[model samples]
Target: MKIAGRTFVVSGGASGLGQACVEEICRNGGNAAVFDLNEEKGAAVIAKLPSGAGKFFVCDVVETDSIAAAVKQTMEWVQETGKPLGGVIPAAGVGNPTTILDRNGDAFSMDTFDFVVNINLRGTIDLVRQCLVHLAKTEPVGADQERGVVIMVASVAAFDGQKGQISYAASKGAVASMTLPMTRDLARYGIRCVTIAPGIFESGMTAVMPEKLFKGLAAVMEFPRRAGQPQEFAQLVRQVIENGMLNGTVIRLDGGLRMPSKI
Candidate 1:
């Protein structure tokens, strides 16, 4: 599917990887709707793009009503503008590190586990489910008869989770696993599903890590020996959208870094 003149909704588009997707989309002649809770950051991101190339919506992925409303508003905007709904990227997530047992030997809090699953896994599922409604309505654009694409953000932790990453790993693993089934389920609609399992990316969340810890993580990379860039992630997202045959798979953007167990 060609991205030019199309519209895409990006959850968590205010910063980090999502921000990169929005910027890339706008630069390539497509418009984007940024669904994020951070109004100030979202506005700032939209301001940098051409007028009408981006819109910001205060959406909390954890809430079905919030995402539904955002989708509704986006659909209305697309209807008025005649731009087809091209894709959706669920990139909002949290990674609060917590061990199963603390130094004092206390069990992990169920609340934390629930919070991570709800936000990372459930939130992503709900957003896609809601958006698929509108995406299904779009006419196929390319010879492959593709209507839209859904790009989910998983993490390398899903495969090689470190200590204190049980909740995060489970959530991301679920996301990655869903790619194949989701593709099968949505194939009839000509909508594709794919997951991106990124390794150590220099996102806002990782920017605050101690230098020693950062260096240790970087050392694991075989080449470049550094964190992945947001633009790299965005580039893959674009490729997945344009490539008709890319579907129902998990693509790793890790630079050959396999995480070691953290004690």
Candidate 2:
């Protein structure tokens, strides 16, 4: 609902859409803490904002220990200010393409496949569980406002999982699949769960693609014919928070373009 005075934890807040969301939150007078591996960028982001209980913590979200530590630090801060840790954004994720035809297809280097699933799926679940624990300590708002809100970032690959996207698809698809069940499980406590499934956007993935390739991809966006902006996605996040009724939804932020199987 009202962004001001709320406290939020944004994972992967060092850059990209997570960074934009953090900025938007601070701009709206809400306090925030970033949990990410990029300590340099995370610290810089915190410094640039108008400081008011906002800070950063280094975390390899794939590890339960790290997630628990993050929640510990965040709860400590919230307790200092007597504000509830209102919600979380598990926007930390990685993507790579590997064809099923490759000899390594089934042999997905435990290094890569495990890393992806651990960070994308397990990290998300870890945060949700921790949030529930902390939310239980807070009081729910009488009306539409929730005790907490969880917004996860899933890729369009989860939907159009291309031929070479075995691991990536499975990982993100898990996020897509869990949105509703999570909402239902958390409803009695006044907690809301939502997912953001972005299409080809100007994320780190597109940043590495060649200009020609990027342009070719952009030309195919279902409506805008261009990659959506981080701010656009953040705006939708704000909308989700305000429209309390919009829960258990995995919004496709890709301007109508279904991924052609990211491989």
Candidate 3:
């Protein structure tokens, strides 16, 4: 399906990779509804877009009510703009570095694991399912009878869990695992699902990492020897939306980076 004249719902669109996707969509003549908790950042992102090209809704992906409300508002905005709901991209996630046991041999906190999974895995699924309720109702756009697409964000850690990344990896790994089955389940509705497994990139999550650790991670990249830029990730997101056959798969956007057990 074409992006122009259609609206896409993007969670975490106020910053990092999500923000870049919003910018790319608007630049290509599509509208983006940015769902994020940070009003200041969300407003900033919307301000940079062309008038009527973007809208910001304060949403917490972990809350069912918040997602329901955002989806409702997004459909209302779509009606006002005369733009059909084209797709959903759940890019909001979090990573916590916690081992199964602490140095003193204490068991890991179940609370911490639950928190990470709730945001990264459950939140992703909740957003997609909520948006699908509206997206599946839209008229099919092309000869292929396509309604919309879903692009979820995973991480290289899903494949290669490093030290102290148990919760993070488990959450991301679940997301990767859901791609194919979810796509199959949505096929009857003319909706497609895909996942992007990104390597170490410049994001809010990584920006706080110590310099030594960041550089160590970047060093593993085979080519260019650096972290990915948010724009590069956004470009892939656009291509996946335009390419009809990119369904039920996980495409890694890392620069030939096969992460080792230790970063």
RMSD of each: 1.0, 2.0, 0.8
Using lDDT as the measure, which candidate wins?
A: 3
Candidate lDDT scores, in order, read: 0.92, 0.82, 0.93
lDDT of candidate 3 over 1-263, digit per residue (tens): 78899999999999999999999999999999999988999999999999999999999999999999999999999999999999999998887788998889998989999999999999999999999989999999788999989999999889988888999999999999999999999999989899999998898889988788789988988997999999999999999999999899999988888887775
Error of model 1, residue 13, in angstroms: 0.2
List residue ranges in candidate 3 displaced over 4 A. Answer: none
Per-residue lDDT of 176 in model 2: 93
Rank by TM-score, descending? 3, 1, 2
- Model 3 RMSD vs true structure: 0.8
- Candidate 2 lowest-lDDT run of ten: 99-108
How far in Å is the alpha carbon of 189 misplaced in model 2? 0.2
Give the higher-lDDT candidate: 2 or 3: 3
Cα lDDT tens digits, model 2, 103-132, are 744654667777778889998889778867
lDDT for position 170 in model 3: 96
| Clashing residue pairs, backbone N/CA/C < 3 A, model 3 | none
Please report, as a residue range, the 10-residue window in candidate 3 with the lowest summed lDDT: 254-263
Deviation of model 1 at 60, angstroms: 0.5
